[model samples]
Target: MRSTLRSSPQSTPAFSLIEVLIGVLILALGLLGLAAVFPVVVRQQRTAADQTQGLIVARNAEAYLRGHTLTTTRSVPNASVPGGGLLAPSDPIPEQNRRGLDILRYQGVTATNPYSTWSFNAANPDRPGPWEIPTYSLVYTNPDRGNMLVAATNQTAGVQFAQRDRLWPAAYSSVDTRVDDNKYANEPRYIWDVATRRVDPGTPSNVGDDGIQFAVFVRRIDSSIRVSRRDLINDPNDPLRLSRPTRDLRLADVLTGDRLGLGGVVTLQRAEHRVAVAVTNNSNSPVPTLNGEGEYAMPMRMQIEAIDDPDGQGLSRFLLPSSATDIQRRLLREPGQKFVDNLGNIYTVVKATFDKNPPNTSNPPEVQPENERRSILVSPAASANAAALAASGDLQVVFTPQVPAAVHVFTMEPR
Candidate 1:
C-alpha cells in the first residue's frame, strides 16, 4: 500500500481492442484510396510519354522535310513500274509557288484501288488537307530507311503509301527481334506518319521561293487491326445499291474463332464465327473466298463510319460497339483525335455520344447479343465520298482503313 501510494500518478490506460481495430480500419481505407489512384497515375504517365514522343517524332519529321529540297519541275511517271500510273511522280501539293499545287486525277475510283490526291477544307484553310500518299521524289531520295520505312508486310492491302508511311523509333527490321540480350528490340514506344501541305500564300514576297511555308502533319501510329473484306453483293433490302452490313461486323468472333460466319451473311442469332485460313508462306493478304484479312492501322488506317445526325449538325460519328472485337471500344475514346481516311479526308473526333446497351436478357440466351451500339462524333464532317461509295455498285465491300491518332502540325519554311 505504501509502494502503491508512492506511485505519483496512475499510468495512462493501454489502448483497447476497439481502438486497434479502428486504427487498422482507417489505415486500410487510406490504402484503398491510394490504390485507386495508381491506375489513373499510370494512364496519365503513359499519355504524357506518348505526347512527348509524338513531339520528338514530329520534330524529326520536320527536320527530314526541311533538309530535302523540293523539285520545281513536273516529274513524269516511269513506264517501267507496272503500277507506275497510280504513283505520284513529284510533290503534288505546292508550297510557296502556287503552280506546283496541282490535284492528281485518275480515270476511276475502284474499291480495290482507292486514289489519293490533294484536298482542301474550307473549315481550316490555314492548314493542309488529308493525306493518302506522300510525294514520290521527296521520300524516295531520303537515305534514312531505318526510321522512314514501314515493313512491307505491314502495308495495307489495296492501299499502299508512297514508300512506307510508318516512321519507327528504331530500325524497321528490329521491330520484332528474338535476340534475348536485346530487351529493347522491337519495343517501339511510338510509330508515326508524315504528310505535308502548303500554309501561306504561294508568294516569294512573304516567304522566299526556297523558303516556302509548309505545314507538316505528323500523326501517331496506334494499332494494326485486321478485319475481313467481304465481296460487294446486292443488298436485298435495296436492290439498286450494294449492301452495307445491317448488323455490326462480328470482328472479334471471326478473328478469334476457328471458322468464319457462313456466306458473309449478317445473322441476328449469334453463331460460331471462325475462318481457318491456311497459307503456305504465312502471307497476311486477305484469303480468297475465305476470311480475307485486311490490316488497318489505328488513327492511320482504322475504319470509322459516318453517323446519321438528325439535327443536321454535319457531324461525322463513329458507331462504337460494345463488342470486344470493335477496336473503337478501347481506342479513339478521346476527342480531338485526328485520322485520315482512304479518300484523303482528315477528320478530328469531337465528342462521344450516348452508349446504347443491348438487351441484357432474352428467352434464349444463345440468341442474345453481347454488343451495344455506341457512337463517336467527329468534326469536318464526311464528304459525299462515303455516301457515293455506299451507293456505288462496284465492290463496295472494301474496308477503308481510317487511321485516327495524335497529330502534331508544324509550320516551318523548308530549307
Candidate 2:
C-alpha cells in the first residue's frame, strides 16, 4: 500500500475551539432566557390562585348571610354595655364566695373594658353584711358551696330591684360588639393608640367588633372565672410559709403593699377557687325577666371577623376593604397576622355589614364596601327566633363558586 498519510477520522478537527465555546454560550443563553420566564410564569400562577381564593371567600360569606334568617342573627340587646342588660340569679347558696366587701364590686369599671360597665351590688332593704350593693353588679358563687346565691343582699324586684322591667321590644336592639387589645402579662401588645391616643395604653379604647359573640345575660357556671395569687414578699404557701406579707395581709398592706414590694408582688402559683373570680360582662344578664322568658338565654351579636372553615384555616383579612376607616384599618392590621406570603403573594378580606341599609337588590346580596360597615337593625321579632334553624328557599348556604355573585374579596400581593 502507498504509505499516503491516511489520517484517521479521529485525527481530523471536528470543530474548532471557538466553535465549541460558541455552542456552550448559545446553550447558556437559552437557559438564562428560560430562567427569566420561570419567575413570570410563577407570578402569574400565584396571582390567579390568590384571586380565585378571594372570590371563593366572598361567596362563602354571601352564602352564610343568606342562610341566616332575620331571627338567628339577634343577640342580647345590652351585651358588653355599661348600665345595660340583666343577670339571672343562682338558686341561692348560704356559704357562697361572699368574701370581698359587703359593698363589693365585680366585673365593673375596675376590671371591664369600655364596652362593658361595672356596678356595685344592688340591694336596699335588709343589709346582709354592712351595705347592700346600690348599682347592678355581677356576682359569682362557689360551686363547691352548692351554687348558692352570692349576690347583692336580700331583695325582690322593687324600686331598688326593678332592673328587669325595662323592656326590650325590638328583636335586635343593640350591636353587641367591641374590640380588646391583645396582652401578655398585663402589658399591651402595641403602643400607638390611634383610636384614643392613650398615652399609657395598658388598656385603651376598643375599636372594631372582635367578631365573637358576647352574652348579655350570662347564667350557669363560667369555668373561666377563677383566682390566682402572686408572691407577696414570699410565696404564701411556701415550705416554711415564711411569707412576711402573708402574715400581715391587711387590706391596706395587701393592696398598697404597705410601701413594701409586696404591693405589686404576688404569688405566681395560681389556684382555681370557685369562690375567687374575675367577672366579665359575659357573665351578666342583658335581658332579665321576672318570668323565665330570658332564662339561659344570652344575647348574641354578629361580628365581622373571620368565618369558620371546614379545613380549620381561618379566613384572613379577606373582607377588609380599602374603604375601611382608620380605626377599622388598624383593627385589621393585627400584629403578627400574615397578610402576604413569601412568594410575593397576598391575601385580603372583604366583608359586608350585617346592618347594611339598602340591600344589594342586584345580584348576590352585594353591598357596597362603605355600606358593609353601617350598623343595621334586626327587628323581625323574636317570634322568628330559632324557627328557621335550617336554611330554606332559593337562598341557600353555598360555600363554593356555584353562586354567580361575589360577596367577598381576596387579593394577592402585587408582583
Judged by TM-score, which candidate is best?
Answer: 1
Model 2, span 178-292: residue lDDT tens: 2232111221100000000001111223311111111111111222322233334465444444534343222122111122242233322112222211222112222222122
Per-residue lDDT of 155-246 in model 1, one digit per residue for the tens?
12122222232344533333223345323254333334444333322221221222222223433332332334433233342342243433
* Model 1 TM-score on a 0 to 1 scale: 0.41
- After superposing candidate 1 on the true structure, give the runs of residues whose Cα lies further than 4 Å from its correct spot: 1-10, 69-73, 76-188, 195-337, 341-370, 378-405, 409-415
> Local distance difference test, per candidate?
0.35, 0.25
**What does the lDDT come to for candidate 2?**
0.25
Error of 2 at 346 (Å): 12
Worst 10 residues of 2 by lDDT: 189-198
Say which candidate scores most in lDDT.
1
